[model samples]
Target: MTKSTQGFCFHTATSSHVEPLPNAKKAMAILRAAGMKKINFAGGEPFMNAEFLGQLVMYCKETLNLESVSVVTNGSKVTKRWLAKYGEYPDIMAISCDSFDETTNVKIGRGTGNHLKTVVELSQKCKEHGIMLKINTVVNRYNFHEDMNAAIEEIQPFRWKCFQVLIVPEENGSEHTLRDARRFLISDDEWRLFNEKHRHQECFVPEGNDVMASSYLLLDEYLRFLNKGWESRQKVF
Candidate 1:
């Protein structure tokens, strides 16, 4: 199967309450020494730590000289000044947008409301700033049947990623982390039907469980290399 990862993906933390790692600049030096060509900074919301996030992005682009430095954000705290100050470094700015409707987003725990509005504005800012904008959509029972063709066409992101909602064995099986997601699970046939509609879109990119499960290299908040998502084991520091 194909993978979404080409280089490094740094997951700062899972929630806003979790403290960020110390010595970010030093970590970048280590990654640069390891010859990382691409880097992605993710978090409960990386923008929550705006100052550090901006500096780290610059470090990757200017000092490490990585081929690409990008961030995966929820598009809530994005602002023109934030983009202007740190936009020049990253090659792609990705946003996680699941539903186009306001209520649907709240129901799915993606956001409170007005998510699509924020995304739309951010899309324009990305274009204005010359940053390649990408949207990552996690398909689930909530949004499986909704037709997003019109909205997608309007935004015209450089790349549109559609992922089949993932339920890891360690997560959705026992009930420790996030097994409740099982309520929103969909079958292969259901996913294919959804994909068939947008398959014609030139920018559409699709990923099934196989790709999302363990294909990418993920670094945890402590800068430890985790095996993969939810079911991750064997943390290599």
Candidate 2:
């Protein structure tokens, strides 16, 4: 399941206090019973409530015996200590790094000055802890022109997934959301060009809007299944 948990610090108003651990554990059991083997935690910054996220990760691996468990993060809030404790449980740690350039990353609203540095440090820690690293890049207006080959090679992630910046009405394109991402939208040709430039990398995996739209089973913070619509996610589990 992609976006297995939806509370993110920067995107949604997901309160850690409101999510019941017992209910979440029950949800995991349901997924396991349904034959779901791999689960990825995304939607909001998983580290916002490190304890909660760690518990879920450990449960998926140790108790549920899921084939693979992963989490995607912006790499700022991750700490070495956290990895030391729970890293063994996660099969992969995918860090979002849109651009290697710090300025470009800041412009893209990824984080402050040290975004790249944080990703590098986190990648190293994941390596030490035996968690395979993956790099996720969103190709947008601010970063489509930049070359990320060197930085990605340096990090040496097992996979380098690049995506065309997608604009969903209520998600990132509307005023009601935390981020208005229309300005970041790029043309199909631009997206293709970005992929073409980096196609030489054996690890490169690019996904455009259409492929990204229908690819995954997305769940919100409330554990409601999110269905893709022209504008927003309109359905429930």
Candidate 2's residue-wise lDDT over 81-147, tens digit each? 8887898899999988888888877777667778877888888788789999999888888889888
In candidate 2, clashing pairs total 1
lDDT of each: 0.74, 0.78
Worst 10 residues of 1 by lDDT: 1-10
> In model 1, where do residues sit more than 4 Å from their true spots?
1-22, 227-237
Give candidate 1's whole-model lDDT.
Answer: 0.74
Best by lDDT: 2
Measured against the true structure, the TM-scores of the candidates, in listed sequence, are: 0.85, 0.88
